[model samples]
Target chain A: MLKIMIIGATSVIAQETARFFATEGAEFFLVGIPADKLVVIKDDLVARGAKRAEVYEADLTDFDKHPQIIESAVQAMGSIDAVLIAHGTLGNQKAAEASVEVALKEINLNLLSNISLLTLLGNYFEKQRRGCIAVISSVAGDRGRGSNYVYGTAKAGTTTFMQGLRSRLAKSGVAVVTIKPGLVDTPMTADIKKNFLFSDPATVGKAIYLGMKKGKDTVYAPWFWRYIMAIIIHIPEFIFKKMSL
Target chain B: MTTPLNRLKQYKSWGRYPTVEHKAIHQIHWRSDLPDVNQFEETVLPYGYGRSYGDSCLNEGGILLDTSYMQQFIAFDAEQGLVRCEAGVSLEQILEVIVPCGWFLPVTPGTKFVSIGGAIANDVHGKNHHRAGTFGCHVTQFELVRSDGTYICSPTENAELFRATIGGLGLTGIITWAEFKLKRIPSPLIDQEKIRFANLDEFFAISAEMDQRFEYLMSWSDCLSGGDSMGRGIFMAGNFYDPPLGAEPSAKKLKPFVPFDLPSIALNTLSVKAFNAVLYRVPLGKRVRSIVHYEPFYYPLDAINNWYRLYGKRGFLQYQLVVPLEGDNEPIREVYRRIAQSGEGSFLVVLKAFGDIASPGMLSFPMPGVTLALDFAFNGEKTLKLLDELDTIVREARGRVYPAKDARMSPENFRAYYPQWEAFAHYIDPKFSSSFWRRVTASAKSANGQ
Candidate 1:
């Protein structure tokens, strides 16, 4: 069975993804915070027909623990086929502005943690000579706008870091995939406008699975998100910064 | 999956589509070409003139079998106005050779850089869509290299394949050659007429009336127009120029300007809105007729090369959605109203009327409806919100957005647009896929799994 490790598996996006992998007859190693929530997700994965479902409770902000945590997860899974760095905290922009600690935490959680995890996995996969690593970046990474520049800055760094990683790992047997999601309708953004074109978590989950299977380096979840981002990114920055969006 | 890596690094460069980056490059020899009947069974994307606006041209990290090297004219029957050529031959190339012989493409897209194969692959339609439909309609026969690499002459012999290959987006096979019914033209010029419409209703009235008299019709709408005048636009109608009213013939001089890249600040709401206002007010409430060259009439934007760069390094997204004409124009009007109210300034908005000509592709993005295309810059959160709202309107209207132009539609919305999506899935080669394809199909597969 294909052994898949999904970081932040308790996320609505990850739950849907776990269900997809379960249906595909694969084993899963789900990692998330709060042990109880992980257990609930684990049971759901098991009930959905995953060959084996295991969970690890760890804080992504603690960079030092990522190597050991990923190593342990890989050991339990026995030769990791794919690793999805999907855990992220969409921290409050206003809160981040008020405290440097909050801003740094956002950065560490969104970019630094993923970087450390990716470096560990990249090394592991290169050594194994066969594996895939998929990172869930956001379309916000395409360009920085005033509305969400704090979050956009973090994602931008992650996306750029992933691009560099992809170039480095292209010749190696390891494949790195970056997913740029526009808007996803999940617990994360439940209060957002209903008319907002947020993709269903299930849809995003499927895209992640297919992207790994196809070995696509970068995927814009909900294909149209690519175009939407394209137009926004193309806007003149001078004028864009003034807009209230 | 092992072959000698012929590293033609430069060939793997950029394409019309920004998302797709070249992966592997292969060179095919035209002298010793094999007409195998099953060469297309493998993951093969039919490459033509490389004029596709997106990833349809080159499959990054995949094989791009360049067909442009195989340019050869097979035959031309002047009496019947039938022209046949290798798929690699472009419309520009054909026009250069045959326009003096009083013939032109029956249906031409905005650009002449497209190949006959690419044209048929996309089932491209021009301003004359209401009258002539798409280029696929004029095609008489084509040779499809099927999945298994067998060459099948698809006209009447393999009729299903013929229809499938027409708008199949090059998924079925590579087109080696094709025969199209060309139209006879008096000269390489067009008799053009420009008219201004005060609002959406007036624009529709003028377009409907002109459709019966003119061979081609198109409209440029001021998307910035708000409130009651949301879809106000300018209508342009044209017909073949008749020898330019007894004037002495002179050699045509083509002006070319290559814009390497524009400063990110070149295109803005202020400038675009200004351009749109001037365009709308220029022909103020009057119809002006003039004789114009074919270049300006067909490809007005061709004057600026790498024009996409004008949107700046960040690039622009093209949103083209089609709403069915159910006798009530409310659906379209409401969409425009939302766009205007949203204050997401989109300057390049084109409105057109699509007739009953059907596309053979299971997931093609055209039907009997009014299609509107707009360009917007990615402005972060606000743009996302605008697109989301647009998607809702399109979904409620039971309309679909063009996949080629789209970069952010959900899988559920995609399914709603293409009900025959399952059939498309069956045709996908296991070894063939792209970032765009993977994102779409991966979501589709998961949706089905659920």
Candidate 2:
């Protein structure tokens, strides 16, 4: 069984991804912000056939605590086979535009915090020379939409950082998977009006798990998002800037 | 009141027969955070999956406690083959974890999209009902959360609540979590056999013989068949098969999809007849025995995601009724004859014989009878009138219609089929009500001069 560590275990996509691994009888060290939610997810993982599921409550934004969290997870599992980073938020774009404080707070949580954890994990995995790291980015990162530019920018930063991390870790035999999901019907997107294009969390979760196992560098949930995003990325900047998305 | 978590929305059942405007909808994430049925100023009804196909899952001008977000597996005992999961967990989710481990649901409905809670509430039956009984028979226990407090109910503990909650249409309370036994299967493949029967008597004879040996038994009838050809269809039976270790469960991914709604004209008489004709001819003259994956054997319709879109935006009313086979199946034949004569044909006409195992639910729909289910495109009054006629035939036969699939069932017939409605009513949380309950009760009260 694979020894997996899931950061932001309480998030809908993370919980679903954990369940995918749990079904394979994997060992898990779950980290989330809320202790209660973590306990619930941990119990659920065990029920889904996880050999072992342990949870730690720690805010992912606390950069200083990243090393300790990674250490605890490694100690709990003995060895880490894979790590899934699925904690991020769709911050209020209007509020972020109005105040630098909101923008910085979102960036810290969605981008910087993840980079800190990745750095710590990178060092450990580089030394060990084996493991897989997967993170959930968004289709919004392909192009900045005025509606959610702040959140999009954070994901864009993470996606680029993952590219660099994947290239650096390639020689060391560590796989870095950047998962870009489009319009997932998760609790995070509960407020957003959904259409036919929306993907279910369960579907996205399976894709993330399978892509990580296959050692893919960049994976798109729903598969169709790859082609859709390709067209969106190539839209002329002058026309894209003038048109509201 | 305007919070994203608790916002007013218009919701409809899978049938899309009746759309109701609810005061608000609260998507429950944690069982601890669930409000009591009485806690809401407006009435509350727990809605799961929204695949009930009728008004049973809907509440008008009330609060719908959406439980889809409450999905979580709590505990599982591999040795005991028991699974405990939050009520919102879908059968599809459970199958993902258990199927690979040589375990399967004791009873599964046509689609795996329905939630565990919804399955229990409807006390749904599968083709193997002749062997396994309704879904509730396998349910060991479930916690019912009400306005007063949460209560644990099982066969031996708070047994009345357990009986009432099953097939209670979610009136008793919101089921927080449930534990049920899973049947152990040797492999994810089924040894399937399909035989075409010429008439109702042949169908019955074939079913009786198959039920004695097969683990699962069901049939599909061409509703347009009449005269000597009436009830002519294919009888299908399956048993679990052992496959080689290299043989894997069909990957859940790669579903064939129906991207958009088909025009209403696409399901018209000419089109439906054409489709049914082609489908009925599929078996041909060859011996219809094959080793098939459990996915196709159990959930053939699931192959096409959103196949319901074929019914169009107006949706179709799925009229399903069961009549006991005490003397003969004349009453059952009469119901089919009326549908055939009316020229209102359902694309999917499933005829199955229910086994004699009585469900523990007070208002469970299935009994020792033959059930005929048909989907009539919603053409307003025309379809409703046709359904009323079918109900009359069912009432005369002493069989009842399934409430979970009914958008329109006369209260008189419902009372006749389930005389235990008055007894079941006492257990209904006053804080809970549904559009189906309101429609049936109000009509019944009016008929009784109330």
Candidate 3:
């Protein structure tokens, strides 16, 4: 069976993502921060039809501990075919302005933490020369606006870093995909607009699953987002900067 | 009549036949009748229609068994759309009988002159190659006559031999007959959309977008242009024609065959370049969808019968190669640069996307990549040298030249392209050989000698 490790397994997206990979006959290495929540998620994944599921509790902010955590995961499950990096904190922008520490924490969790994990995974995957790294960035990164510029900036950096990694690892047989999701309605975005153009966490998870198989370099969560963002980002700067998106 | 057999020899008459090498010659003892094929064993090269543009047919004094007269359909299942026929049958022959019945060959090469055996041997690709893959992908099964003089090979039994034989260049054995899956169509016509692009970037974007809907796609490039216009071409995307009310009569007319060869200098660089320029300039729009006949859409050059004669007495060499899309167009750009510098203007340059479907043949040509095919007249020693240089480029890029259209590629190039060549060679019957096989193997041996 193919070994797949999903970082941040207790998250809402991870629940559906784990279940999807399980039904596809993959052995799962679900990693999250909390032990009790991971146990419940693991049971849910197996009850939903996972062949085998293992959970690990590790804080992603502990950069030095990532290597061992990943090594243990790879050891628990046999050779890993894919690494899904789906860990991030969507801190409230208004609250972030109250404290510089909070703003830095948002950047650390969203950008630096994912970069550290990817750097470690990049070296491992490059040596193996055959694996996939699927990163979940948001469409907010397509262009920074007043509404979510802080979160968008972090995602933008993540997306760019993935592009560079994709180019470097192309000939080595390792594929790096940057998934840009638009207005996803998860617990992460529960208080946002109800009738807004938004994709569910399951829909985004399925898109990621299919995009990896197709070897697409960058995928918009819902394909319409490709054209939607194309037009949105192409508007003149004067007009785009004035609009409160 | 028995007075003097020597005196009777002076009155003997000989009839000329066309060959793949563009040479007209008389057949010695070889005839179509199977009983008269005592000279034919496993070593003999069986040729039909003689449209292979290279030495695949002429074995250079070796036994050449003519299979053109083996044209007869054994069975046809209208319900399932399956066809079983002798190897000698031609596409034109099938079209004549089946077009009225609303059936068509699943895959066809550029020309209708190819035989069923030649099609299987070459594993021909058509406009729809991007979506459907190669000819071997659709072939259900074929009966191969092996060295043991026993014909007992199908897709399931002797599976390796079946895979090797399809694109094996007739090296494994003689293909006596084949059963293929036929495609059912509304009529012998096409609904085409001509989309023109000013430069390479537009061409790439247009082709990728059109690939979503169209079943058939082919592009024509102006090889004479350089720099920004290097890969500038026109894209022709089409699907099976759907006739409008009260307009079905035109599709029923039988196409007249081209009986005579054209003038020698009819297709010069200036003429072809001018023709391509006009073709590229005429269709200037997002999409121009219209009703067109099948002969023009699928076989555009077939309008001029004996079109190869236009290349002069020297014949022509077709170079076809496929390179994986490594997310960069630099390799393709380099090839076009080399060809442009060579000052050899090709009459027809076709570019297509080879889809995700893998080839079943151990040595089949098409893979998940982008394929470029061009035709050049044999302009003496320089033409061969230019092709060899291009072969080197392809080899370095981990790409391969199509064996069916190749006459000059070294065996090293063959091995590099088909990693399973040794495995394919294991299935080769000693009794079966062709001039194409001898030249390639000898070239390979010499390369190894060096």
Candidate 4:
């Protein structure tokens, strides 16, 4: 069984990813904010055929506690085969635009905190020389949107960080997969009007799991997002600036 | 305190009738995330796939623990044919993996979209029920987490909780995970045969004769048929047949889905009657024997994805009831006559017989009887009154209505049919409550002082 650590165990996508691993009888060390929900997820993971489902409650934004969380997971599982960083917030863009404080906090939560965790996990996986690290970015990261530019900017920075990390870890055999998903129908996006463009979390979850397993460097979830983003990226700055996307 | 992820939303059961707004729709993606059962003052119910045809899956103003995110397959023993999985793992998901390994669900409901937890809570029965019994019978054990503590229950361990949780309608507590045995099949194909039955008597006669021979048997009756033509329908029976190739055919990745809800007038009695008449003649006109894939054989409605949309935005209710196989089929005949006389002809009227096998669930709907299920478009009071009249006939015959398929069964009759309600009620964790439970028990307390 693959020994895996999920940073945000309760997020819809993370839960879906955990399920994908559970089907393979992976051993999971789950970390989420709510203790009660973590226990519930652990129980569910165990039932879904996980070899072991150990849980720890810690706010992902608490940068100081990152190393200890990883230490605890390593201690519990003895070793780790994969680390899936699926914790991020779709911070309210209107608030971020209105206040510098909100923008800074959103950046800290979405990017800085993730970078801190990755730095620690990257070092650990480099030393181990055999593991996979997957992070969920967003299609918004491909090009900033006026509606969610704050979240998009953080994701863009994280995606670039992953690209560099992928290059750094290329020779070490540690896979760094950057997943960019389009309009996933998670609770974060529940209020967003659902349409044909939206993807189910389970489907995205499967894609993330498979992309990591296949050791793909960077992938757009559902495959279609890659083409959609490609088209958006090619738009002239003048046209893109004028368009309200 | 409520979690940050909590949100309020409108919820509806599969029937789409009686939609209600939930104040706290907290989705528990993990067992540990659940609040201590005692912490919540408001009513609560674990909602899994919301596949129940009625209010059993609804909580109204109460909190709904959405379990869809908790789906996972925990363990699978190919040698023993046992699969342990989280309560939220769907039948469709299970089939995708297990069917390839030559294992099939021991019991399955009509729709595969339902979660394992919902199936057990409802003690759903399938065409194979005559031989395999309800879904609860095959479940070896399950873990139920309540407000006080968590309990691991099985037939030999915490057996009372085990019995209570099955067909318990999520009131016993939240079922986290369950282990059950799987039936093995040589291939995904079934050797199927369809026979035309002119009346209800022929349905009974043919069912009795074929019960032992076929592993799965069910019939579709013409709901509008009355008098000399009453109960005219088609009878279908099947046994697993080895595929020409050794492998069970892999299912398609994409299935066609209904785009949107049709108008309420889209499916009226006239349309249903015409469709039923056409269906009645199709089998009768030909020699109906074929080796077919199990997908259509087991789940015909599944072929038309989101077919419930056909019922319209107002939604529809399926009134499925069972009467004991006593007194020369008079009770079942009366039921058909009343439905026809009411002019609420349902296109999806199914008739089947349950064998002598009894399920372990205290509130399980299956018994040694004949069950008739019909789909009726929601027409407010008119539909409810029709169901009430049907309930009277069922009560008179000492038969029971399926809570999973019933939105409005009288509390007095619920208690009478399920005398074990008092016993089952004792095991219900105070933290867990549902619209069905509240409606039934409140009325039971007022009407009969139970």
Best by lDDT: 2
* Model 3 lDDT per residue over B332-444, tens place: 77888888899887878888877877767777888777789988888877888888888888877888888777767777777777778778889888766766677666645
Model 3 regions lying over 4 Å from their true place: A1-245, B1-42, B244-249, B253-269, B284-286, B443-450
The numbered model that scores best in DockQ is 2
**Docking verdict class for candidate 3:** incorrect
Share of true Cα-Cα contacts across chains kept by each model: 0.00, 0.50, 0.00, 0.17
TM-score of 2: 0.89
Taking the tens digit of each residue's C-alpha lDDT, what string does model 4 give over B1-450? 001111222457878877878877666655545666566678789987777878888887889988875665667787799888778778988886677678899988877888888899999999998999999999998999987788999989999999999999999988988899999988776778888888887777778888988899988889787877899898888899876655544434212221211223344434887878877887655347776677777777765655667778989988888889985789898888888899986878889999878889988889999999998988888888898899889988988899998788878878877888998999998878888888777745445523
What DockQ would you assign to candidate 1? 0.01
Model 1 residue B134 CA deviation in Å: 0.8
Q: Write the per-residue lDDT of candidate 4 for residues A97-212, one digit (tens) a residue.
A: 99999999999988998899999999999999989999998888898877788999999999999999999998899999999989876878856766778777777888888898
Instruction: Point out where model 1 deviates above 4 Å.
Output: A1-245, B1-18, B29-42, B244-270, B359-362, B425-434, B445-450
lDDT of 1 at B348: 72
> lDDT of all the models against the reference?
0.71, 0.85, 0.72, 0.82
Task: Evaluate candidate 4 and give its CAPRI docking class based on DockQ.
Answer: incorrect
Of candidate 2 chain B, the 10-residue stretch with the lowest lDDT total is B1-10
DockQ preference between candidates 2 and 4, better one: 2
Better by lDDT, candidate 3 or 2 = 2
iRMS for model 4? 9.8
Query: What is the TM-score of candidate 1?
Result: 0.58
